[model samples]
Target: MQHFLNSSFTIPAERNEQLESLLKIHCHVFPYPAKTKFLEYGDAMDGVYYVFQGRTKHYILAEDGAEKILYCLSSGWFFGETPLTLHEPTGLISETMEPSILWKIPYSVYDKLLDVNKLFRTAIMNCMSRKMLIMRHEIENQVFNPCKQRILQLLCSTVDNASLVEGKWYNLSSHYTQYEISTIIGSARVTTSKLINELCNEGFIRILNRKLQVSKIIYEEITDQMDLL
Candidate 1:
């Protein structure tokens, strides 16, 4: 598979706008505050969702009840297709990370669009393809890479979603706690802390006011090394 360490896998803006316009007529738009757990494991999948104005985390609970983040969705991204298409209950928990607007298109509407709208069909297929690639990359990282490398890879993968601060350092757009970072990297909190400090000392990354930032040079270096690997 192609390298995906730095891929955000977001849909292109033009196609995203087209899809949004098409769904607007049939969707129920809702405003949600940060930390809204709108969908949970085993909930009936009544519709597909599109992010109009916020970020969300999609994850599953481990046997020990720990949350393992599968991926994050930003504005323009769509989700809930798998369970909806399969006529099964939701298998992942989806929660908003910030105050946002979302569109919920009923299953009947979604099905009709898939059958009648070529653009809609193509966009959904592309979304599924990208999701599969991301999952494959995550699995390979977990099985083949060390914890520290995995952590770096995660940071690299999020660069597109981060913002540049003072025109020099890229600040992670989302505020992630050490515990959350541990869960994402599949490591213990204490171990994650130590490794984060190690990365800081080596100039790979730094934390300011509890927000992680990486310099452009360091970001490029990490991506380069990842490419070689």
Candidate 2:
């Protein structure tokens, strides 16, 4: 249900209710210690997860003081697959949002189970494809878009395609700092802050509660890019 909440399109209520029941069929539902920085990029994770309760943020850091937020996961989403299939590392910095509960399983064990139940392999392949596509989209957004526009676009996109009513506003939940945004957007802190003020003056976005709040114009600009998409 939460995954679909950030989706580009609507989903049926019944399907939302069914996610939990279906998740139990594949992974171990157990509490995991908080602050666990699990598998990283290029390394392997033995299995994927359907986070039953918890939050994790996926981010990549560059030595030059750049940080790109790749994606975030919460309950009802699955992550960590390379260890399970290719027997490789996850190769990303994954941090838990709190004391968490997750449905996890081992890939090697899954392979053994799949030797008899071939259908599981097919399911894994499909899930992997979707996750890869999402990663690609995140890279594309940061690579080409301007920081202020990109931030507005991302917030609006995550809010599920609805236009912000004129004057409607709220702060970013993550409290993502300007330094962090600069790192993620591949810009310097000064440049990012300048762009942000420009956005505010132009009536496209603003800082409220020390967080970014976008206007309908910002939303329009984002959709304009997709008009080309």
The TM-score values for the models, in the order shown, are 0.89, 0.67
lDDT of 2: 0.58
Candidate 1 lDDT at 84 equals 94
Residue pairs in collision within model 1: none
Q: Which digits, one per residue and each the tens of the lDDT, describe model 2 over residues 65-160?
A: 356656666655556765556566666787675678877766655666557654455555655665666556556655765566555554555442
Go through the candidates in order and give each one's C-alpha lDDT.
0.79, 0.58
Q: Candidate 1, residues 1-229: lDDT per residue as tens digits?
A: 0374433322222336667788898999989999899998899988998888878888889888888888878787789999899999988998987898999999999999999999888877877777887788778878998989887766766664357777767876455778877877788999999999999998888889878887778887766776677
Q: Which candidate is the best by TM-score?
A: 1
Q: What TM-score does structure 1 among the candidates reach?
A: 0.89
lDDT of 2 at 213: 69
